[model samples]
Target: MSKRDYYEVLGVAKGASERDIKKAYKKLAMKYHPDRAQGDKSLEEKFREVQEAYEILSDERKRAAYDQYGHAGVDPNRGGGAGAADFGDIFGDVFGDIFGGGRGRQSRARQGSDLRYNLEMSLEEAVRGKEVEIRVPTLVECDTCHGSGAKKGSSPTTCPTCKGNGQVQMRQGFFAVQQTCPTCSGKGKIISDPCNPCRGQGRVEKTKTLSVKVPPGVDTGDRIRLSGEGEAGEQGAPAGDLYVQVHVRDHHIFTRDGNNLYCEVPLGFTTAALGGEIEVPTLDGKVKLKITPETQTGKMFRLRGKGVKSVRSGAVGDLMCKVEIETPVNLSSKQKELLEEFEATCTGQGAKHRPKEKGFFDGVKQFFDDLKS
Candidate 1:
């Protein structure tokens, strides 16, 4: 009988991507595999047909020739299909993503894991920078074995199962698949005489004291990296990096945003009415701030170059001080009398002395009058 179309055999479109073709072939290959056939010749034929289609469709040159001139262009043979697609590669392509890339390859030793250390700092400390010492407990190379994981007199032996190749080939009827050596667990070396300090793992737990230099203007969420300061790798691999995460605490008098600093300063009632100079706190000590005459509450004043100096940009930011009028509390009898006399003088002069208060009441009266009308 004439052969079926290659695309039809794999149940994929002619415009299917290479990943899609491989996905479809893997699905069909598993479904009609000889192990699941149970002596069914039709299922075996379907499996062979799927292989042939994949063989021609998988390769760029062969797929192009077959697409242009059909199966006659490639003149593919039976069984393995064109003899270009290896059975090991077919099995690997089917399960490579799940089993870590490819098979028959040496299993690489994993490097040390990166570590994170949370470093808390006051706002003053973050803005000025400091060098602090920290103690970190992590895995370090064993001193007894010197990271070899073997006794001092003896050394590691090659894995007998994989013959030091770190992989083993297993034959299942006609197909052979290579996988990590089970005897050595893919390390290709067996630690027959294990080290006493760290057993056979090559590393031990120890606390390391390290000094970290925190730069100025480092805000919360900033991280400083310390190279080769993390956990030691297995069998003499390179150590990972240590990241010191900074967390800036909330300030009592100031709040920072980007390069600017903001603080709320209480203004005396007299100072709000008659303009005066008051001291405002900054990162670089207190500075005298001038308040304008008739300045209202919630008025903001900017002191240039009084904020933090940025670590990355080296730019000096400004300090924003918002003044809020303070109402006198626990007043003496004389003070209460004076305040009442002052209120009496300003009652009829609301428009001249307190324009905002006069405008707000005028708006309220108009709103109620309009509702009645």
Candidate 2:
């Protein structure tokens, strides 16, 4: 098929100036835009023709060639056509002001990324709080190049492809895409003579030993931030922060809830039956807990201000101790005889000594009587 003339395709005269050509192209592009056309094959074909015609006429070199020699001068088969018009570029350049976001935004030296380190501590250490030392592998700025990424006494040069904008426009027929400059990797600069220690990245890996002071009562899922302790930035940019994620280990004897601590204390059956004082373990020390007569299992006792302190409110919590009456595991013959005799004394006592047991059977008896009725 015969190709249309570039001037005729854009509805412009042969003597049209660059500004006039650009204005005509913008109007035609908006009208024939694939988004506006909604998959209309004829509009898409017209858009392609408009794109090809504007591509040839928009540049001085291609336009001059086409004006002198027609389609043969700007043919890709003949090693011509350096690509002047792009779909996204038309919107970016012509309709950018109407829709916002057409300006080129360049980046400077890129900052380092933030880092996280999981720190595990014992419950005692988390409750009482202690200073802990940790080793973290991270990137530090190179001393030889002073974070410039260039060799000593030399400096980085601006990227030639992106012109220090750290971005480049790529075109594929009607499609246009903006991407990071491959030459500088979005740093806007290139190091011709990279530092020997850190190569071209401007930072080197090293293990840093840091001391973290844990506040009193920092529980699991708590975080401690260390400012400027993360990886060093590229090309002398500012460093990011390091977060220490705390996980308190489970204790053998104690479980914590919010600002309180809960523990189960085993009480001797004799001590539960007769009132007595027993020493129980606490984070502070052994504390005496008084057991009242007829104390039952699952009975909870509170020790005021003996638990973990609140890191946020500065209030001390109470320690809740649940007593579980322990039955005798191994019994001597004499102990078994004595227990039998003691049971015989309470055999006809009804609810006097065992109120719960008597009440349970009374309810069971009433349930059977109702069934009979």
Please provide, for model 1 over 241-325, each residue's C-alpha lDDT reduced to its tens digit, 9 standing for 90 to 100.
7878666767899988767899999999899989999999998898999999988899999999988889889998999999999
Per residue, candidate 2 scores C-alpha lDDT tens digits across 1-373 of 9998989999999889876776677567657766668979999999778766776787688898788777766766432442334224434644454444556647587667767776778989999899989999999999888888899988898889899988777666655556778998877888898889999778999999999999989975566889989889878988877878666766899988778899999999999988799998889999998888989999999999989999889999999999998898889999999999999999999799999999999999999999999
Using Cα atoms with residue i matched to residue i, what is each candidate's TM-score against the true structure?
0.71, 0.71
Each prediction's Cα lDDT score? 0.81, 0.81
Q: Model 1 — which ten-residue stretch has the worst lDDT?
A: 76-85
| Runs of candidate 1 exceeding 4 Å displacement | 1-103, 169-179
lDDT of 2 at 210: 95
Clashes per candidate, residues 3 or more apart or on different chains: 0, 0
> Candidate 2, which ten residues in sequence have the lowest lDDT sum?
78-87
Which residue pairs show collisions in model 1? none
Q: Report how far residue 293 has shifted in candidate 2, in Å.
A: 1.9
